[model samples]
Target: MTLFSREVELLQLEQDPDPGVVVFAFDLETNGMTTRCDILQIGVKGFNWSTDEGFVQEFNQYVTPTNEIPQHSSRVHHLARDEDGDLVKETDTPGNHEKLETLPIKAALTNMWEWLLKDNPPVLLVGFNNSRFDNHIILHHSKICCEPDLMDRVRSRVHFTDLRTVLSQRGEQGNLESHYNSCDGPPLELHDAISDCTAICWVLNGKAVSYDELRGRAVSLESVLQKKNKSSHPLLIGKLVTPKVAEKIGFITRENYLKFSEEELIRFLKTKGVTKISITLCVKKWRAVSYEADF
Candidate 1:
């Protein structure tokens, strides 16, 4: 093939565009992992792939759950249905039905939908654990908050991107885990809406973690933990799936990662799933960490 042809082929494999585009980073903390789960918080981060603008905001509210949030859930998330709970500050946002500062779920959802639709966006929705959980909650809450048709319109018009699944697929052992428990940081402390939003924002805009640094840490940890081998997982997990394309194996979209030539495949394998932790600890991190942030 000619040089131009070769350049085009390589470009086809890249996920992020050069400039002038943005991605909407999304996350939701829920009461459970099932369809019956209640969404306690919605975290949104907007990242510009082009201009590199990123910002996060939380629309947290107390919901009268159809089912109770389990005690373990309360322990992990502290989302008890307390009449006096600080999930929302009365002065920050007040409404009888657990709305954020001034906007109820429906209104907050509208802001999202409009932001997405009106932006003339070459944008997509992103969530850490969004595929199975965040998307469901967004669909559910949108329906409850607005008409079914409106929700359908949002679903049809807006593209949903799941960062967790992609990160997981690229995992050394097929799972990328967030290390929020140890000395490392994942913005887990606030346990409140705003903090998680910040974390998600940092992640999508490519500000959250780095592989070069993590690899250095992994090498050090191996020496301290007395392990013979350092975990190889962090070196594999990356931004595998792209909303710009169709995903095949969770994060590695069918459009390209699966179609990579042997050369590109090697680069992708080395670069795709290389997260910030070792494979051994990555799995534990995934299992131990509770899913936070709502899409």
Candidate 2:
């Protein structure tokens, strides 16, 4: 009777889960505002909600620009070429000192790309005003460096989340520092790329906005660029003119620029104090546009 009754046990099999996407909050300290300017430093802090207890990875690198760091920009980030022709970045903390080593833009960007894709998980790039500024610089440099693979990967796998826009939607106002202060975040060292990235992570990690909300707000960088292109003047897209020059002309988009005659264009450029060489460049670019239109 005891042998007739048998007990069977079933073992549950556990399958490994796929790697979860990472949220990489990044910041770039640049030589200037324009895409032509160089990125002095790139700081990234990655948070993997699935596995990480806090920021799991950090990447900080100094980039040596082909151009000299402008004094105005240096004043902000404390990065400059020392008397020995070596690049140096001063620390924000008065007593604390740090060594600064630089990499060429191509090497720096490649390293950054490697770091971002290390886990082979999809990445969400986040910044305070990345949609307009940071993303553009990244895309532009990627193109300049002829990194088709990086551009393709960025277009496909990497998406951008602008914390400034997200916070604005949430009814929180002001810059990154302002938002961080609102969250009662830790003491922030402004202007340094690493500090800024950490601050961004702190703000997003705060009660005001959850990480889930940031994920929901993510958008492809290509879409954002496409939208901007649609609204921008063709010359601006082609880099025939700078934004500062465009604003000075009082014609932002191609449509507005077309409304004026060549004479009016020259007059406006003169009044705006645009350099004679730049005025010639603008007029030549305008005529080239007209010629292309004829085709």
Candidate 3:
């Protein structure tokens, strides 16, 4: 299915709030950075500020992984396998207790989706750097688990606001720890998914960022996936080389673009009066796409 882009508007709670809109701050802890990695935990905290609702809904689940959690990842999230090969929470991990019950990846995903869809209001998911990481992991696992219909439902109904992007645009630090500290947010245990979700809520409220402003920056899951796919295209279509630009540059097809070496492409673009900055970006996009293609 093609991605759809539609306008989303969230009303200010103080001015004119819409009780039908629910803003959910969510987070996911994964085994690794790649899409192939398994999600270890999912956490969410939501509110309907229109009704002065405070943390109306909360969800937290630990996902049992099919593969072993790498030491590097375990070091960060404090979830690892013991000598018996059973999943265990590391000692003194924040927000984690000694007793941990985990669900299979599919079950965790399904449960989370069910919880998110329980309410009738339109859902807006807010996360820190989710656009680059957590969102993709969710999408990837959902696809592999044969939950395309659920994912489609989510794409059509739920919206996403990348808190990191919003903060960066406002010239504030984008990383959660830095942003949280800057806003004088309460003590937060950084890697815990639920704790991170709470921190996002705190930062949003501290900054007095209205839901309307977040909605203005929100995007659909489909659009996010589409942008990601476009970036990986051999020609980097819609990213560095649009159709019109490709035609103008005598690189009308992926094959034409691939025919030139990086040096050759840079020289050609220079001849066309492309600035050095644009040329650098073009090369960077090209290399990223090409690198992905190699694998």
Candidate 4:
């Protein structure tokens, strides 16, 4: 039997108006910054910006992890305890809590897919810097817990868009916060899954008309950026380089990217002027994570 069974059809998409299109933007808070890391929370918000009709649905879930959250990762999102024996966040309890009910990784993923596939499938699957992070993690876990066929079905029907690419193409100083502030978006609870999702959507709405446009822009920008990289440095494909160094090569998995020392991280930034996984315009945080940067 195939892994995933639920598949969403395009369903007369060509006839639909721009305002009728559904765009789902999501974010993930994880125990660490890798595809192999456990997902801590997921937040998704769907809306049609053309009509400004607001969200069709907003979903958020907390997932219990099988592994303990690391000190570095906890510092970023505060999902686990630190060496001082303090919980990452006061509200983040060990087990299921009142506000955020915790579920097993597989169960949470199944629910996430169900919520996403409700009524009609989202025309676009968007995230701030999802191309290299959230997408990989979701797809990785979904393969084991959910049906691979269902995951494939979902993939076949939806288009993926990364808002970070758009900001990078704009040039000068760029990051999620600056763009969000420029758009007059509300203050964000940084690192929170749902808040990040909302912030990303608002920023996206302030610019692009639809997911198709963003996808096109991301593709064009990626080509331009990669070509520029090629001009400066030889392409380092399929080489057994250090994890920190591998990011310079392009989109390494989290497992491979995190295996570096402080010196390597510093050396990479000072020399390359950009993180391996991110450009100067878009600063890399945790595994393809984009945050504020001094550009």
Candidate 5:
């Protein structure tokens, strides 16, 4: 039920206290919704929370995915594209994506990771809907690049913050554009990573208002995403399970399943002959549901 979790064992800021908490907000544009999906671009911005100061460093890059950009995906961001299939920018026109010199998938992810850790004290990784989407995409690509442990390494280096959770906890709908519109904030660029990152920073800055306010609610990034548990069945879904036994039984699939709260997950594990369990994320319901199988 809590929003943020910080790991004290990973705290690098204790020795150097003056700069205050660091937040590195970033965004990702990807090709699709599945685990093996491609990431088209990334944008990052770093700032000091106490003084609300952004560091001189910012990162933006378009990446060439192994797969060509799908038409539906391209429609979301509207990046400049040519017959040669390269992303490009218009020389004298407005509303066109900047010139599309792009890095390879591995290079882009590595570069973004390096830039985030450039500071002496590590920066927290913050993202909009990161737990559900961005983090997984990053992880999948990291694995493809043969750096299977990259995300775990990052998690160990700094805390991860989810802007969506904070917004929802404060009773606002967790959509980035909706929040931006309500504040009369600038129009979001929709799927452009840099523009979206900037918009998120604006929204978070407006809501956080003070470092103490954010730090109090910050949670560990490792605790936010999918966790593995021992069971004969695969438990393959990506969302967290609610903690309790279900009042009713439901069908299960490779891509979908029920969920349990932390307590519920434990109880389900204890059930006799319970051989399988699945965790499902209901985007419409905005919560993870636990599905159990007594096979």
Candidate 6:
């Protein structure tokens, strides 16, 4: 739904008004971070910006993959091949595939956006590591699962926040593996989606924050990308728009764009059919993700 004063008010009630009107925090477990990866499940929590405290909502589903769920994925989530498992599993078996109706998850997500709108409030999407991966998965999978176009359409005005960015912005490094070591408490296991997500949430337990990578910010997208490159060995494609930029642009799966040649960039840019000037302005934002740029 669109963000308006009244909508924002109702959202605030749901999220306890952490800062804006409503902020919904969620966590997701997937086979991987690609359109190729199956969306195993999703867990969501909505909070009010004004109050900081919040209520919870959740949606979890298993997908009928067009591809196989890798063994590596199975190890991370600790998802069992059978029921009563500690984590959710990706099954290609006949019976597991027939578990749900047209949409494996009927009540959860399809009706969630509407339920949040019932209050007519502006909602912020918060997640342990979303705003990038999870959000992309939800959008891509919704399409894959043949859900309403309205689901992805809501991106225009959904308030979004992610603890991962906060950690990165705070200059924290290392995978989730490192976070566990630095903490005074126990280490967080990585492949377990909900557990890993909950650990990230612990990082933002007391604060409510929001950010937009596209909008105006103190860090130019280029500069932020460079720092990311300098931190690593600089993979072959890393020289292009840097992994950081790629991730920010919502293609975290691609190592980097540097490996792509100018011809590739041009061919990519050319692939788009001619469109109106107004539409061009919006599509132009993707110029970085859609093409080549490097030091």
In order, candidate lDDTs are 0.44, 0.66, 0.68, 0.59, 0.59, 0.43
Highest TM-score, which number?
3
In angstroms, give how far residue 270 of model 2 lies from its true place: 51
Tens digits of per-residue lDDT, candidate 1, 53-113, equal: 3553334443335456566775555555545433432222333333233345577676666
| Candidate number of the best lDDT | 3
C-alpha positional error of residue 215 in candidate 5 after TM-score superposition, expressed in Å = 4.2
lDDT by residue for model 4 (1-295), tens: 1111111133335333366677777889987767688888989888775656346678888887677877688667767744443334634455532334578888888887877776645456677777767776776677678876666545545555677776666662466677778878767777888888787777767765455456454222112223334332212221123444444445255332332223444454556555434322212243332223332
Pairs clashing within candidate 4? 3-147, 3-148, 3-149, 4-147, 4-148, 4-149, 4-150, 247-276
Stretches of candidate 1 exceeding 4 Å from the true structure: 1-15, 50-68, 83-104, 120-123, 172-194, 205-295
- Candidate 2 residue-wise lDDT, 96-166, digit = tens: 43557889999998888877766554577889988888888876786677377666565546677899988
Compute the lDDT of residue 86 as modeled in candidate 4. 31
Candidate 5 residue-wise lDDT, 225-257, digit = tens: 343122312233322333232323322321122
State each model's C-alpha RMSD to the native: 15.5, 16.8, 9.8, 14.5, 8.9, 12.2
Quote the lDDT for 134 in model 3.
83
Number of the candidate with higher lDDT, 5 or 6: 5
Single out the weakest 10-residue window by summed lDDT for candidate 3: 1-10
Per-candidate TM equals 0.49, 0.67, 0.70, 0.61, 0.64, 0.50
Worst 10 contiguous positions by lDDT, candidate 6: 274-283
Q: Could you give candidate 6's per-residue lDDT for residues 198-278 as a string of tens digits? A: 444444333333323211112211222333342332222322333453444444344224323434433433444311111
Sort the predicted structures by lDDT, highest score first. 3, 2, 4, 5, 1, 6
Error of 1 at 142 (Å): 2.0
229-261: candidate 3 lDDT, tens digit per residue:
644432343224333565666665643444333
